[model samples]
Target: MEIKTIGVVGAGKMGNGIALSAAMAGYQVVLQNRTAANLVKAKNSMENQLQKLVQKNVVTAEESAATMARVQMTSTFEKFDAVDFVIEVVAESLDLKTAMFIQLDTMCKKEAILVSSTSTFSITALAAVTQRPPQVAGMHFFIPPTKLVELTRGYYTSDETVNQAKAVAKQMDRVCVEVKKDSPGFIANRIYTPLFLEAFKAYEEGLASKEDIDLAMKSSYLPIGPFELADIIGLDVLKSSLEYYQSELGPSWSPPLSLKQLIRAGRLGKKVGKGWYDY
Candidate 1:
């Protein structure tokens, strides 16, 4: 199917970025969030990001305006009935995402493709909740949206569905890496989780301060340190991913006590102005 309209559920960081990218790619976009406040915040955030792009000469003012014009923000899932493609970018909780998949399955057109941006969950499990499992897949985009997108297939996902998703990713100018297995964390997080564990262990063991560890890793190869990246990705999100990994992978994937303490204190990273480092 030829996709022209894209629907994104949730208006947080990843959701807004994905919507903006689609709009910039010249697709009509529907960005949905449950709350009015979040919708407004997402609009403002997108506008600011576009302005930055304009200043950097990455996009002209006219181009930025056109991109914004292509996006329609809504608070109801009913608006998604006509969208040709829908991406769920809600919190990384199985129950929450499964409920969303069920709703999308009911609301979206039969030909519409449904995908999740979850970093560490089973695409097959989510597909099982919907009747249209063959149309379901995982399209994991990283925090801040690099050029890479991990496209994963569930047990029931069809080759046609994967091909369509890859086409959409290509339209958005992203490079696609197909993941054959329906494994937890897919590829990126499988590698990243171990790095994160070592970082946490080093800090917990008092080998170095978080700042120092971050500084040491910030080289020409890696633009951001693990702690800084964690802050931007949100500590709560990190903890949740770790918990999910621990359950599916092993005990080694468990979150450290210091991470839990920070979360318990309500420091959820840059979004909240506090995390491993205060903003």
Candidate 2:
């Protein structure tokens, strides 16, 4: 099916980025969040991001305004009934995402494709909750949304669904890598999670300070240090991903002690102004 209108759930970092990209790509976008305040914040955030793009000459002011105009922000899922595609970017909780998928399946048009921006969760498991399992897939976008988007297929996801999802990612100007199997973490996270585990373990074992480790890695080949990246991604998110990995991968994937301690103290990440590093 041709995708003309897109629905994005969870107006947080990932959600807003996805909505903005779709709007810029000339698709009518419906960005939904449960909280009105979050919807406001997301709208303002998109405006600011578009302004930055304008300043950098990545997009013209007229284009940016037009992109912003294409997006419709809402607090209700009812608005998604007519959307041709729905991307769920909610928290990485299995229960939360599964529930949302069930709701989307009930409310969205039967032909609408449902996708998730999940990093580590199983797309097949989520598809199981919906009647249109063949239409459910994973479209995992990175933090910034400029990098690669991993397209994953659930056991029942059809070839047409994968092609349609790839089309959406390409329209958003993102490179796509297809994961043929229904696996936890797919491609990027499957490899990156182990690196995160080692980094956390090193810090916990006093092998090196996070700063030193970050500097060492950045000075070498990485654009950003693992710890810094973790903080930016949210320690809570990191811990949750780790827990999921441990359950699916092995005990070695368990979150480090220091990581858990920081989360217990409520230092999530940059959004909260504190994490492994202060903001």
Candidate 3:
């Protein structure tokens, strides 16, 4: 299927990044948020990012302006009617995502491909709640949406759905990693979550400071340390994912006490100006 127009639900960091990515790739993007304030924030964030791209010479000023022109921001699903593709990038709550999926199913055309950017949720479960299972799949983009896009097929997702998602990813100039299994966390998080948990455990046990632990990992093979990554991801988000992992896997996957305490204290990470480390 030809995906010329893309709709991104939610306009926070991830949502805006996805909108920017699609627009940069020449797709007309309708970025939807929950409120007018969010729409304004998303627009400002996209503009700032475009300015950075222009400054870095990744794109000329004319190209940046054209890309910005392609993205339309909204606070409702009105634009989704003509959208050929819809991606829900809402928070990782299952109930919230399911609700959004159901809304997308109702608002979009039957042939419109529906995708979720959830990192640790089941695409199968989300698809089951929709009327168009064959058109539903997982297109998990990394936090920045500039790294890799994971194209995944749920239990009921069709080959056509998978292929169309791949095409969409290629159009965005992203490297595609096909996730065969419909399991929670897909591929990256299966490896990532363990490393994150171990980092928390190590810190909680006083084996190392968060700074030193992150330093060690970065010194070895990673671009950033686990605690630092967790902070960027939001401590609340990491704790929530860890809690989900514990429920799905076992008690051993329970979130560390240190994480819970930080969350309880409202230190949600860089967005909030505090988390594993102060920003």
Candidate 4:
């Protein structure tokens, strides 16, 4: 679709990180949030991430500032009307995302591609809300956007959007992988959920400590164990998604009781300073 500028909806961690990544890839970025405070935080977060890139010599200081400059944060969704693509990065709620897509469908140009970052919802339901099924698709990015190297394609996503999203992913230096369906959690989650659930089960059954399980994963060549990654992704977010998956997939994927209790106590991983490990 020849995307030049992208509209990122939501200023939470994923939205802000996606905007920063797109800006670093040399695209003009427009990011929006419903609240002014979140918008400000998103901007600051982008700046801080750019600074880290400069520190690591991945991006020059001038380049980092200019990349940071390319990103504009707004509280107005109306500004995204002209963007070539609208990636809905809002929280993981089907109703909220569908409503935003319906609004974007009315506000954006007909040709503007709509992509959802939803991890569990079916794209078919979201596409039904927009009346642009061919133009609507999934463009899931792994957490910690800087190192994103995998993406999932929805069942109805057009080959054109897949090609376009792959182009964008390449620009971000990601290793793009296609999924045949928008199945709950797509391929990565489909494969990893069992392992994660097993780990949680073991912990709940008092089979082993969290640290030992994590060490096993690291020793076995996995970058980090599920619990460790869940901590980074926020335990609350993971817990919520687990509940969603359990409802959608049944008992085998259900979140263990320990994880639920941990989230209720507010220990949501590295961002909150306590989870499976000390931050």
lDDT of 2 by residue, 1-279 (tens): 789999999999889988988999999999999999999999999999999999999999999989998999999988888999999999988889999999999999999999999998999999999999999999999984456999999999999999999999988889999999878789888888888888888888999999999999899988888988998888998888889988988898888899989999998988799998895
TM-score, one value per model: 0.95, 0.96, 0.96, 0.91
In model 3, the runs with Cα more than 4 Å from the true position are: 144-146
Q: Give the range where candidate 2 is weakest over 10 consecutive residues by summed lDDT.
A: 139-148
Which residue segments of model 4 deviate by more than 4 Å? Answer: 146-151, 277-279
Go through the candidates in order and give the clash count of each. 0, 0, 0, 0
Clashes of 3: 0
Q: How much does each candidate deviate from the true structure in C-alpha RMSD?
A: 1.4, 1.3, 1.2, 2.1
User: Whose lDDT is greatest here?
Assistant: 1
Candidate 4 global TM-score: 0.91
The digit string of per-residue lDDT tens for model 4 on 1-279 reads: 589999999888888888888888889999988899998898888888878878999889999889978887788877777799888898887778889889998989888888888877777778878767878877787775545444455556678877887788899776777777767887776778788889998988899999899989989978888788888787777777777788888877777788878877877789879987778
Which regions of candidate 2 deviate over 4 angstroms? none
- Over 44-156, each residue of candidate 1 has an lDDT whose tens digit, in order, gives 99999999999999999999999999999999987798999999999988899999999999999999999999999999999999989999999999986699999999999
Which candidate order results from sorting by TM-score in descending order? 3, 2, 1, 4
lDDT of 3 by residue, 61-87 (tens): 999999999998888898899999998
Error of 2 at 154 (Å): 0.2
Q: Model 3: clashing residue pairs? A: none
Global lDDT for candidate 4?
A: 0.81
